[model samples]
Target: MSDRDTRHKASMEKLKARVEEKIASANEQRGLIIVNTGNGKGKTTAAWGTVTRALGYGYKVGVVQFIKGLWECGERNRLEEDANLELAIMATGFTWDTQNRQADTDACQEVWKEAERMLADPETYLVVLDEITYMLKFGYLDIETVKQALENRPLEQTVIITGRNAHRELVAMADTVTEMQEVRHAFNNGLQARRGIDF
Candidate 1:
């Protein structure tokens, strides 16, 4: 082999050995708390990907839309057809748009009940709390309440929390935290959000 190809093969072989070692050392398996947060987009979209993955395996899945209100969601439209999925969307579109603190808080609490149910369901393999960080950010949902619920969830049931500005406590406890940084968006360039692509 050429010198360049020989060096690349050795480097890849070393990387494979390291990865196999780490995989072998991970003996125990348990539920995970995955946080998707940042100012960028795709937070909910990534969680939806996980939702579909779980459903494809015939596992029961639950979703609670803490901030997403009455709107056309293409992902939701497709996922709704599955019998293993349970979705509860909030009534208020956006707290900023509604400008009603009491009403928004009320809706948050109501939907939180559904989230609590999903968290407590042992049969549910995965639960997606989409856009829930907003409720926590707005102080509509208590951080302690969420923390306690997460702490008490089934040992083998994973949960995904997606939205910007995830609380420190949530970040601390999460097994995986993905922050989507906004580099540049087309909306900033005077282009409207496309239906299938943006949503």
Candidate 2:
């Protein structure tokens, strides 16, 4: 082999050894709190991907949508077809569209109740709180209350919270946090959101 190729192969072997060592040392099997947040798109999309993965393992999944209500979502439509999944789209619409603070707060509280129920259930393996940061950011849901629910959930019930500007407390509590940065988007050029791609 060439000198460059020999060096590359040795580096990859060392990296593989490190990865395998870490995997072997990780013995814990508890559920994780995963957060997907940023200004870019795909936070909800990533959470739904996890939902699909959990469902493939025969896990019972629950989804509660906080800021997107009554809108047509292709992921929701597809996920709902699975018998193992249960979804609740709770918001009337975005805060700007609803223009009713009291109504929005009331709706969020009701949706949170459903989320809490799923969190407490041991049978529910995964719970997706889609766009939940908006409710927390708007002060419609108490952060402490939400934190407590997540903290006290079943040992194997994983929770995914998705939205932009996730609160500091939630970020601190998350076991896995992913921030999607937007470099460029098609909408910036006045291109409207496409049906399947954007929604």
Q: What residue runs in model 2 are displaced by over 4 Å at the alpha carbon?
A: none
Give the Å error, residue 107, model 2. 0.5
Q: Stretches of candidate 1 above 4 Å error? A: none
* Model 1 lDDT per residue over 92-189, tens place: 98787899999999999999999999999999999999888989888899999999999999999999999999999999999999999999989999
Clashing pairs in 2: none
TM-scores of the candidates in the order shown: 0.98, 0.97
- The candidate maximizing TM-score is 1
Find the 10 residues in a row with the least total lDDT in model 1.
65-74
Count of clashes, each model: 0, 0
TM-score of 2: 0.97
Which tens-of-lDDT digit does each residue in 17-52 have in candidate 2?
Answer: 999999999999999999999999899888888999
